[model samples]
Target: MMTPDEMMTLVTENALEYGPKLIAAIAIWIIGSWVIKLLVSGLNKVMDKGKVDPSLKPFLCSISGIVLKVMLGITVLGMLSIEMTSFVALLAAAGLAVGMALSGTLQNFAGGVMILLFKPFKVGDFIDAQGYMGTIKEIQIFNTILKTADNKTIIIPNGGLSTGSMVNFSTESTRRVDWTIGVAYGDDLDKARAVIKQLCDADERIFKDPAVVIVVSALADSSVNFAVRAWVKAPDYWGVFFDMNENVYKTFSKEGLNIPFPQMDVHLHK
Candidate 1:
């Protein structure tokens, strides 16, 4: 081993030899940080000009900035005269481990990105997906929020929604309302059809173009079932459905029609 004084001098010389590279790395880091900020700011301006969704903008900007800064850090490490090969290998290994550990979470993140970009649905839309039906309340990076018709809040993972089939009812301008009305077998089928047709004509919500269909649907043990189908604008669908039910009952009653109820004849064998 060398003397203490000799070792000290050698150590000082090594540090002096690498001192300029270290200084350069610091300089690059500081300048690159500012450059990254400037680039992120410019990107934000471009995205804003594109009129992207408000909720998606900030997340995209943040992810972009982080990626850029990570690349800049790698560049700085190269300039610092440090052995970057081992560092890169270690980083790769760490990333792989983390990715494996958080596979489910990463899937959700990817799904969220797809949702933001493609916009399969949006807030306030009444949707059915993954066996859940509700109005979307909010959408976030990991999950989506929903409010059920019964006023219950539901949180759904983005991964499931992104991969599953979804039905957005609110997107349609019109929907069909269907109901089966039962009448006594002895009642006049022709007059029942006329009365239902009159009821359909009187309803303003029912669309006139496609027209309404009223026909015998099935022969039940208790009565003859007549199916009534009408189309109405989506916004007025529920209202129209309830109103039609009430109107049909009243119309049948006023027309002296016999509404049938299920009956069973009981017999005892002794």
Candidate 2:
């Protein structure tokens, strides 16, 4: 559309205008990247000195690096003299859309952060929460993994886990194991109490300081119920519970203590 000389002149002018900016942009990018690396390294050291949780360190570093890289990108764009107003506006819009779409995911991410910081439960602690009971295996960015007693693995999202109610059985060193023992209405109360006391004393896991509590809780139609409660180390809870039940059953039989069962008489008239 134009003479060759004119076209050449126009091209030269355009190159003169943008050439330096392009080179400067590239140099800035390279230098900014190196600076970002140094900053991130320093941040890691600071976190280590602060004794931040091991699981949280890498996550913090990753987020810091991403934010720094994004800021570097903006600086490079400015060096190129590219208009940032529209670009920033478009970026904001896109980010808003993406954020809306990933609302639940974002909640999980926040929840994970809260949990790592607050430390409601750590790995290997036994917990009952969200209708599942298992030992915590790993706490990840968006999920908490659990290993069940039968060796099954469970994955629960952090959103509900962080906010919901949880029972950490391993939090306390001692736990109370409760049992309801019943004897026949006519059974010897003193003998039953002595026998139950002996059984509890035989188990070394049971605590002596708190002492054992055995009381006649209820007298139902079929039997007199004994509310037997004992304190034992948390790790020995289930073992002591099952063993005591078995021993009580066998000992009561050997001692001729009758464990009453519900019975009813039915009559028919012709």
Candidate 3:
């Protein structure tokens, strides 16, 4: 056993030997963190200048900086005589547990990154996916948000979206409008076709290149069905659909065309 004076002297010598190292370790960590932030910001600017995908830049920079900072932390801890192997073991175990617990969430996050990079749809595009049709409002880390035509907000997981079929209605600049009308068999087919063609010609929103197709589609027991297919700018699709529907009925009525009502005839014979 050492005397009191000897123990005190030993303590002072240990402090003198280790205190600077401890201060250096802490200073390195704090300064290294600030430096990492600066580097990441500069890297983001470089990526932007290179015209990298905007959505991917942030994730790449953040992940790269975090990995570098963690390595720096380990290096500093080792310099301070800390047990680096034990810290690494703890990190590995925690990572394994987190991976197991958050497998689905990680999959969604990965899918979200893919969606952002590939840009299948953008904000304001009307898309159908996972049995929902709506305009894309936001793209988040794990999910995408949409606003439906009926004014409902919908949130869809990115994992489901990635694995399903996506129909983007707003991808094309032009959209086709097709409407079917049924007229009584007694009404003149020529007259019905002429009315539809005239209606198409009168609409300013309708495109004339493809030309309107007003043709007899079917002959049923009760009535004759005709189909009017027209092309219009995508922005005018809904307006044209509504206008053509109303115009067809009004024009047919004005021209004395007979629109048959649904009816059934039942007879009993003895």
Candidate 4:
């Protein structure tokens, strides 16, 4: 054991070396936390001002805060003279492993970011994509949620949605509704056209300027088909179509028009 004087000298030297570093590290930690809070708040305001997607704002903020805090931790460790070379290398290796494991998820995340940025479709829009038709309920980080007409919920991954073909029905205010109405051969063509026009005019949802188009589309085996097309508001498309079909069924017979069906006659005699 060393003498009492030697012990006192060693202790004094050690305290001189580490005392200031500990105090500085504590002060830096406190200040760094406050700075991080401010930076995160500023990011939120910037995103809001820039009209960034609301669904993506939180995710960006969380990532920024985590990165800032990690940097602050490293700064504090460096102030205390802790060796960080091996730690940083280890961290990089772990990050690489995680990246490899979650490659698909990362792709989905990137897709989600692109979708949020470009905005091909928004919430409440009726869309057809990947053989599924539904209204967009929510857009998430890795998936999108849809609400079908029948009240079923569908979850689609963002990766495919970003890169695949999509049809947005709600993108337009008006849509053309087409139908084929057939009558027996030799029926009044002018009368069929007039009936279709009346049906279209009766519904206020149908457009008047474009005018209804009724023309002889084809001559089938048992009937002459008229192609009936009308332009109507998107919301009223199905309603007007169904109403027109019912009206035709009711009015055609009274108007002396026969709805025909195919008949095949086969004769075999001895």
Candidate 5:
């Protein structure tokens, strides 16, 4: 409604008041971005030095970078005199909704972090958990991949894996193998025991320090059971077990020992 002079004066006043603020805001943004990059780089080096898991390193770096950039954006927005309280509240509300929606996923992610930190098992380790047994193929953020003995692939959720009981077969360097050998009740127990001990002593894979145990464990309905226990390297357990079984059968047959089978003597009276 006024003259042109009024418009020019108002414009000049606004420029005088806000021009420096705009320039300062731009400078802060530039400096903040540079600082964020430097800080993130330093953090990555620290994580490397700490030996963080390889799978988690990239995710951690990405999350940290995003958080720093978001903070910088909020700071720049604040310098521009944008109302941030409402924006912050809106962000909180949205975060709450998303968090609720992805609660299970977040739990799995947290569990994965714990697993990477604690290292219950590693890739290629054989593990049994949650009614599944297999060798671990991968440990991911949400799931663990397993390849079973029968060549089946299984995906197990990390949430349950972290909380449930896990048996890591590869954790120890050596393992004990136990077997029960049943022979006919009339078989010579001392001869059977001697032959079993001889076979165990000849096996190079079996450890002698623990000393193999061959004892008459029980007398069942049809046969006498001998408990054979031996220690072997972790990797040699399965091979030793199968070989011992084969050796027992062959030696027992050659020695004229009878392996008892269930038999019913039924007599019909007419």
Candidate 6:
């Protein structure tokens, strides 16, 4: 209903009022985006310098970038005079719903964070947890991947892994190998002990500082058990264990030591 000239004047007035705000909003968006990129890059450098695990670095960088961009988006929305209170409330409600629906997933995420921070175990380390034993192949946000000795792949949820007890075999540089050797009760106990000691001493992989222990641990009905304990490098544990076992068997056989087996004699009376 307004005249043409009046319409033109109104449009002019509105443009003059809004033009600077629009330009300022655009400038803020551009500057904010650049700043966010810089911050993300700087964060990556800092994490690298701090020696963050290789598996965690990419995940952390991605999360930081997303958070910064989201904050930037909210700021830009505010600059454009969009109603933020309702939007924020909607976001909170949506987040609450998602969180409730994915409670277990959130726990896994938290567990992942704890793992990255505390470093209970790393990739390639053998660990036993949650009734499974394997070498750690990959550590993800939700689960950890393991490769078993038989080449089976297992995926364990991080939540359970974080809470459960874990034995990391590779944590220490050295580990003790324990073994029990049994000989017939009729065998010469002193001669058997001497041969066992000789076998352990000749093995180059066994550590000598702690000294190998060969002791008569138990005397059973069928045989006498000798407990053999030795220390070896963590990596050398399996090799030394198998080697010593074979060597002891061969040496005992050549030395005429009798290895025992369980035997039961049954007599029937008619």
Model number with the top TM-score: 5
Q: What shift in Å separates residue 232 of candidate 3 from its native position after superposition?
A: 0.8
Candidate 4 segments exceeding 4 Å error: 1-35, 53-55, 75-83, 104-118, 220-222, 267-270
lDDT of 2: 0.93
| Candidate 5 wrong stretches, greater than 4 Å | 265-270
Candidate 4: tens digits of C-alpha lDDT, residues 1-270: 999999999999989999999999999999999999999999999999988899899999999999999989998999999999899899999999999999999989998998898889999999999889999999988999999999999999999999999999999999999999999888888998888788789889889979888999999888999998889999998899898889999999889988888898999999
Q: Model 5 scores what on Cα lDDT?
A: 0.93
lDDT-wise, the better of 2 and 3 is 2
Error of 5 at 227 (Å): 2.4
Residue-by-residue lDDT tens digits, candidate 1, 1-270: 899999999999989988888898899999999998998889889978876667888988899899988888899888876578998899899999999999999999889888877889988899999888999999998899999999999999999899999999988788999989888999999999999888889888899879999999999998999999999989888898888788878888888898989888999999
Ranking by TM-score: 5, 6, 1, 2, 4, 3
**lDDT value for model 4:** 0.92
Residue lDDT tens for model 2, 1-270 = 899999999999989998999899899889989998998899899978877668888989999999989888988888888789898899999999999999999989989988888889988899999999999999998999999999999999999999999999999989999999999988899899999999999899999879999999999999999999999999999999999999999999999899888999899999
Candidate 3 is scored at a TM of: 0.76
Residue 240, candidate 6: Cα error in Å is 2.1
Query: Which RMSD values do the candidates have, in order?
Result: 3.9, 4.0, 4.5, 3.5, 2.6, 3.1
lDDT of 5 by residue, 1-270 (tens): 978999999999999988888999999999998998898889889989988898888888889989988889899889888889999899999999999999999888888988887889999999999999999999999999999999999999899999999999999999999999999988888999989999999999999999999888999999999998999999999999999999989999999888888999999999
TM-score of each: 0.80, 0.79, 0.76, 0.77, 0.85, 0.82
